[model samples]
Structure formats: structure tokens, C-alpha cells
Target: MSRVIHVFRSPDRFIAGTVGQPGDRTFYLQAIHEKRVVSVMLEKQQVQVLADRVGAMLDEVRKRFGAPIPPPADEFTDTDPLVSPVEPEFRVGTMGLGWDAEAGSVVVELLALTEGEVDESVVLGDAEEGPDALRVFLVPERAREFVARAHSIVSAGRPTCPLCGEPLDPEGHLCIRLNGYRRGVHIDPHEAPDSDDDE
Candidate 1:
């Protein structure tokens, strides 16, 4: 089947959002242009990396190509939740980012997941045989906003364990430092542990 490419050149809204509670949340990258809405599912780590790379790419563009990249705003205006019906067209497998010098825009390409390994050449390229892709082009300011919102969404998840740097569950956290004995214990890293170190 021919691949479907959902291209949003000047999207009305493009943002990363999640559904459900913290630990059980589902991440989605949604792009909207007029009435058309394209939502793609991806992992939290992917969202982080995308935001980080986009931010870095903007900086690089400014340095190398002399692009007029804008700094992140004091506050992101689009703090609203994701659009209704939260349906995902596909789960993103491989993502591509590039700076369009002519347009002075950052291009983000999210390719759908496949059963086997994906060809690198298909990324950011016009490959007829590749998987379906969702492509969005954003100005420097919009890109910065996206990065900011993405970081906020990621950090909003479960708080991390100060000791092991892992997420702490509501019921309890099984910290590796405690050797699995203290299943439901919440210890402050600043406070000293009990004298029973022999456990």
C-alpha cells in the first residue's frame, strides 16, 4: 500500500500531550491543521529526546546557518490539554529532525512502527516504500514552545527516588539500595538509614 504522509506545514496547533494519570499515562504527539488532526503514540523517552534534539537543532541552526532562532518564552501560552477523541494513527518507530534553511523552519518527521528494522535512508527523505509518516514544520518560536511543553509533560510524571534516581510509586518504591527488603518504605536520602546495615 502507498504510504500516507500527514504534512502540517503551518499547523494550527502542534503539541506533545498525555492521557491518563502519571504512571499510567500515554504519550502522544498531536498535530492539527484546520479540522485535520494527526496523533501519534510514542514513549516518554522519545518525547524527551525529540524535545532535546529540536532545541539543540534550533541552536545549531542559529550558529551554523545564521537562522533567527528565538529563545524559549517565559511561559508557554498553549497549556491546554490535547484535543478530544485522542486517537493515534500509529505508533512512532523512527523520528527525524532537520532544519529547512529556505523556510527557516524545523522539520519533524515521525515514521510509523514496522515489524522489522527500518531503513535509515527513509528518514527525512521521500521513500515510496517506507512506512507512513507524520511531518510537521514549525518556526523557531513554535519549536521552542514545543520543547518547553514537552519537558514539562515529562517532568510531571512520578517523582524520582533521590537515591536510585528511579520513579517512586504511590504504594512504595523498591529501591535497589535497600536490597528489596524495604518494599513499601520511603526513605529520605538526606536522612541517615537505620543502624541495621547488616541486612
Candidate 2:
């Protein structure tokens, strides 16, 4: 699961982004009008939940802003990360309307990444169920045409990793056939201890 991060201009105006990179997962957001920016670093699943909520808000936003607005230019790289490399569309989530009709401007809520801890190279969760994960309300949709396009644009022309099957990290990687932990190889649990203690 990915994360959902929010950027709110007002109680009614808001947006969200999933938080994750090749290995350095973190949410980056900036609200130009409000003169505010926020970054949330959290685990994968928490972010996914938030995304679901935001998806629900899309309809409301559509009514106000008129059809889900195209993702802002600065939001993504020139080449989508999910395509060419990911092959299958890796749609993380959606952006839609919120049910705050009282304020009247279709509320834009994002299925976003929750707040977490971040470092220079990578963003990580405290534990599987720790507070590090940013909970999103919206879930990833099968058809994420918009997100696919955005990832490509933001990537600035980079390839995805062959091993982990994600976008490559900034430093690049070594391509030697690694032993002990091959993708399809299986070792007995009891035998694993002997190998570790030997070290």
C-alpha cells in the first residue's frame, strides 16, 4: 500500500499525493497560494487508506472545479515511472471530491500519505503497525490514467529496477547474480540459522 499526503488551502480546499519513491518513500507537497508546504513520511499501507478517502472526494471536486483537473505540471516528471518499466499500470490512487457541501466550493480531499519520519535517502515506517504510516482514505483504482502520466513526467527519464520491479534509485545498482537470496529459491527455515551463525 502507498501513502496519501494532503495540501489544504482552506478547510474546503485540499489535495493529496502518495508517498513513496524507488526506495526513498516520502510525501512532498506545496500549496503556492497558502504559502505552505508539507512533507509526510510513512509506511506503505497507511498511505493507501488515505488515498481511498480522497478518491471519494473527487466527485465533489469535479462539480466545483469541473472534471478532475489535470495534474499540475510540476507534480510529476517528464516520463511516467509506472509505464515501460512497470508494464502493468501501477495506479497508486485517485483525487476526487469531499462531502463538505456546506462550505460550497467542491472540497478537494486527497487519498493521501500520513505523517511519518524521513531521512535524506529514504523514508521509512517505525514498524509494520507503527504510527509512521500515513493513512489515506482512498484506494488505488484499476484505471489510473492520470497518475500514470504524472509519474512519467516527474521521473525525468529514468528506468525502473529489474530486481525489485520498482523505479531505480538515484545511485544506480550492481547487476551481478546474487546468491543466498535469489527471488525463486527457497531454503528451509531450520537450515537458515546454520548459515547465519556461520557468519
Candidate 3:
């Protein structure tokens, strides 16, 4: 089948957001242009990496190409939640980022997951055959805004465990450092530990 590329050259809004609680959240990257909205699902790590890369790309563009990137702002202006419905067209498998020298814009491409291996060319190129993709181009200032919002969304997840550096669950957390003991749950010193039974 032919690839479906949703291109938002001058998006009205583009942001990263999540649904559900901290422990079980679903991360998404959404782009909007007029009434058109394109949402793609991805892991939290993907969001973090994307944000980091975009920031770095902006800096590199400024240094190498003399692009005028805006200074980092104290806070992000677009802190709103994801667009309504929150329906994701596809789960992102591979992502691509590039700086468009002519346009002085950051180009972000999110390709849909596929059963087979993906063609790298499809990432930043307009290949006739490839997985679906959502492409958004943002100017330096708007790119900075996106990076800020993405960082905030990623850090809004559950607090990490001090010992293991893993996310702590509200119900409980099993800390490997404590030899599989549940963290944050009180254990009486006098009480005997439960033993495992074998069939």
C-alpha cells in the first residue's frame, strides 16, 4: 500500500502528552493544523530522546548553519493536554529529526511500526512506499517550545526509587537492592518472613 504522510508545515499546535496515571501512562506526540489532528503513540523513552535530540539539533544548527535559535525560556507556553479523542493513528517505531536550512525549521518525522524492518530512507525522505508517518516542521522558537513541553511531560511520570532508580508504584515497589523486599510497606521486625512453597 502507498504511504500516508500527514504533513503539518505550520502546525497550529504540536505537543507531547500522556494519558492514564503515572505507572501506566501512554505517551503520545500530536500535531495539529486547522481541524486536522495527527497523534502517534510512543514509549516514554522515545519522548525523552526526541526532546533531547531536538534541543541538541537546534544548538547544532545555530553553531554550524548560523540558524537563529531562540534562547531557552523559563517555562513552556503550551502546557495544555493532548487534543480530544486522543486517538493514535499508529504506534511509532522509528523517528527521524533534521534541520531544514532553507526554512530554518526543525523537521520531525514519526514513522509507524511495521512487522518487517524499516527502510531508513523513509525516515526523512519522501519515499513512495513505507509505513505511515506524521511529519511536522517547526521554526526555531516553536521548536524550543516543543522541547520544553516534551521535557515536562516526560518528567511528570511516577517518582523514582532512591535505591534502584526505578519508578515507585503507589500500591508498592519491589526493590532489588533490598533483596526483593517491598519498599514503602512497613514490615514488623518481630514478624517472620513469608516462605515460598514449591509443588
Could you say which candidate leads in lDDT?
A: 1
Question: What's the TM for model 3?
Answer: 0.88
Q: 124-189 in candidate 2: lDDT tens per residue? A: 222233222222222122113224433433353347666644555578555344433445777888
Q: lDDT of each structure?
A: 0.91, 0.35, 0.90
Report RMSD for candidate 1. Answer: 6.3
- How do all models score by TM-score? 0.89, 0.30, 0.88
Model 1 TM-score, 2 decimals: 0.89
lDDT of 1 by residue, 1-199 (tens): 8788889999988999999998999999999988999999999999999999998998888888777788755468899899989999999999999988778899999999999888999888887888999999998999999999999999999999988999999998888987887557777887966686677
User: Following a full C-alpha superposition, what root-mean-square deviation does model 3 have from the true structure?
Assistant: 7.9
Q: Which of the predicted structures, 2 or 3, would earn the higher lDDT when compared with the native?
A: 3
lDDT of 3 by residue, 113-158 (tens): 9999997888888999999999999998998999999998998899
